[model samples]
Target: MLFRVNWRVKVPSLYWTLMSFSTSHGAWKWADRLRIRRTTVDDYEGVVSVRSDINRGCDYIPGTYRQLLKHNTGYAGFIDHELVSFMFAAEIDNGCSVVIQSGRIKEEYEGRGIISAMKKHSFHDLSRTATRSVSVTSSPFACDILLQRNARLLCKMERLIFATSRHALKNTQRSPKVDQSSTIPADDAFLKNIFLSSEITSTIFPENRLVIRGTPYELVTSNIERILCLSDQILVSKDYGTGSANLISFGSTWRSNHTDVVFINLFGESVDDKIIFEHVHRHVAGKTSSCEDKIIMYIVCTKQQHEETVKRVLKKHSWELLVVHDLYAIEESYSWMN
Candidate 1:
């Protein structure tokens, strides 16, 4: 009903793309309308509705929607005053790069070119200052589309999800003992030193970037504070012989459908360090089980060699492997600015 425009019109920084629609005379018509603009708190309900519709009411979007808006720049598309699509972009690496995420389109409105239009609008808005854009996705369609847009694949990771009750975790295996000296306190100064150390950066992080809670951030001083704020708990294991960090993990928890979801990003020197990996994994699980009853845990392994390590550890703790999928980090560098 919002597509009754009889005359072509244009607005500043916004344009209409005429799509062919069949008419009685088989003539071309422009019946598709998409109005994209910067999203605000007022659009929260609409955003949640579209997200729930797309994900069938099972997702973290509703819980993290406000946080996303508060932390990133968001845009929404509407047709007939009804929100149908949305996306978010966070400026990271001191504005040198932007991470695009939380993109969703209503189920009924798929394949309407809305995603393409939204990408163009969002990128144009960000390209003024950002030199590159990064995104992570598990969808094959999205991968193909990004490749078509000249986006390079930065890295591939395996997303392993373990679902188990706290009771089950406690009953299965004895807690692994961790050396108290190896536990790094969650202090700003201490974390910054470890995160920025050359040893950890070269060996643990993928492409020199830390992907925490599904968002990739460059490991630099400017981002340390921000990263610290985003994580709920950070666990690190130090190699006492060299006094350098060998394993680092971040844990963040959110409630979804009355269940507590714990997401962990684990980085280790190599698969050979399975002992430390298992120790840190047990430590995190022990901490979470103290407060949460129903838990869904997510672990991401960037190195292919470490996938088996992750699975073996989860299995050792009697955790159920609900799903495993490949996650790709893609980047598109802007040549116009360079």
Candidate 2:
């Protein structure tokens, strides 16, 4: 089993205390005007507008609204004909699990229990399908809500992005040559061992189980494909011009805001922060002579694996800590029942 490390930090008292607060009265006042419904293509423009208005510079476009509306399922909160909050999730692993994508509520409409309401309705709807569980990469605020709902925290994820510019990095930075031939082994015993022996996995209730398939290589490939599909959506959602091909060095792109910004999940004994940033810089510089946009790459890691060395490397490169996310999984297929 991986060592049980108490990596959970003590957040501010107010932050913890507020999790249990009932939805604000204002939210109830607006409930009459708020309508919760499945999102459609027609709602895409409104969703983008709301996301941009709330996110500001940090808020990049969510490029997958069209796909989400067509292939996946999600709910949007529209109050007085204005799309205020949007939540979406995609079924993966052959309907064994559902992963939540992007979601947000307008600042003025926050703390009104809108999210709580949205989750209640959304999960209930998803449970009717074949989905056995649900997972989400949650921001601190979302983490609090999951905790309040007694959701299990699988791992804490830290998102760090490197702004790729030719001048942002020193030429000395270089990544080790990746062995293209040494593919992930055809067997998946490694993954089974990792998942079963994990202390975190042991804590999950027996009745609730996560079903998985394919060898580690197969699994990794599928995951990468999904990430690429999502990245394609981002590319279409906004015009950031063309980005470099090697923007994703190791795995697939995890999340993307604009052409310049992207994220990926990387795992290996030797993976380090310097190589990641360096790779992006090389690609972006190799593509354009003097690109100004900050090329951003994000990675998610558990608190335990997020070591001091990695943190130090990111800080040295002036990487931004975007989200202190806690990942969670609902144990049963019908999570709403619990």
Candidate 3:
């Protein structure tokens, strides 16, 4: 475990003593009312209740919550017997890394230091694991929380193109034809070439080494399958159909937590805005089974040109920009400062 080292003493004792004064004064309302405990199957209903009432969609599915509870590691904070917050961490890379699933607090409990307390409680458990890294994909605000504890930005999730409008599909089909190309089944070689391509290299983690350790081949293949299984087809383009040589783009569709996600996982070779939109429109329109309410499309881009192109083409397609964050911390001492 990472915290097995001598650094345990260095982890500040403020958390334990923060309420000492309140306890001595007999005004320790939180001391007795607020309690953090392991989440159990019996608590599922409460968790879901909190979720159903939340203003935003959950970060994970219901089944995931059950699985985390089974591990006896998922946590919940309750006050007056009302579940107010929850969190779970799932190990990855054979326990060398852990991806924090999600941390949530009910709306009424916000700004009460509930999230901070939950982090301290959960990090204690994670610190006892063989984890070497911790990763989280969250919104900008959530990223800020992770950042306070010494995690750094690995990458910003961007460059997504999506649309579900039947009109958009028709418009795309009739839209000015950029050269169109045939789809190629994604293979290891094809994906590797794209990964090593100068365009992708320049656009991904330009300031960092972009070391996505553990099962690159598996990650890519699984992503491809995620699209194929959720959507009817994968979109691949070569030379942007521009009659040019040595250009490639890859795309797929998937669903997450009841949201329809169209992932343009790979793109470049040529930055044809029309081609990008056309592919996304076709994928979304072709898919008969998407989420009941919304179809969320995403892409990862880091270049000014690609970002601009995506914004321009997707504006008319009911697309909205959402920040995707990749935050990480060391396994043992989750805080880099350690």
Task: Judging by TM-score against the true structure, name the best candidate.
Answer: 1
The C-alpha stretches of model 3 lying farther than 4 A from their native spots are 1-44, 51-74, 123-149, 157-270, 287-300, 316-338
Query: In model 2, which regions exceed 4 Å deviation?
Result: 1-22, 53-60, 67-71, 93-96, 130-145, 166-228, 231-259, 271-292, 303-338
Model 1 lDDT-worst window of ten: 12-21
The sequence of per-residue lDDT tens digits that candidate 3 reaches over residues 221-264 is 22333223322444555553453223233445444456555555
lDDT of 3 at 138: 25
Best first by lDDT, ranked: 1, 3, 2
List pairs with backbone clashes in candidate 3.
2-332, 158-301, 159-299, 160-298, 160-299, 179-241
Q: Estimate every model's Cα lDDT from 0 to 1.
A: 0.65, 0.44, 0.47
Task: Give a tens-digit lDDT track for model 2, residues 1-338.
Answer: 11211225322211212222456556566656678998778777777765454222434335545664665576788888888877675556544555544567665675566665665566667755544445443335555665666665543444444454545533324434433332222123433433344442333212123311101111322343444334322110111243111112232221234344444443323334444434333333342333334555545443334444455666665454443433333333355444
TM-score of 2: 0.60
RMSD of each: 9.1, 10.0, 10.1
lDDT of 1 by residue, 1-338 (tens): 11211223321101111111112331211114788889888888887767443222236667777776777788888888888877887778877787767777765665566765676667778657787877776654456666776778777777777777767766654665545567564567866775668866887774777887657777777777768777777777767788676777777766666666767777867465455455445445554445467677777877766667877766776677776766777787775213
What shift in Å separates residue 118 of candidate 1 from its native position after superposition? 1.6
- Rank by TM-score (best first): 1, 2, 3
Write down the worst ten-residue block by lDDT for model 2. Answer: 211-220
Native-to-model Cα distance after best TM-score fit, residue 51 in candidate 2, in Å: 3.0
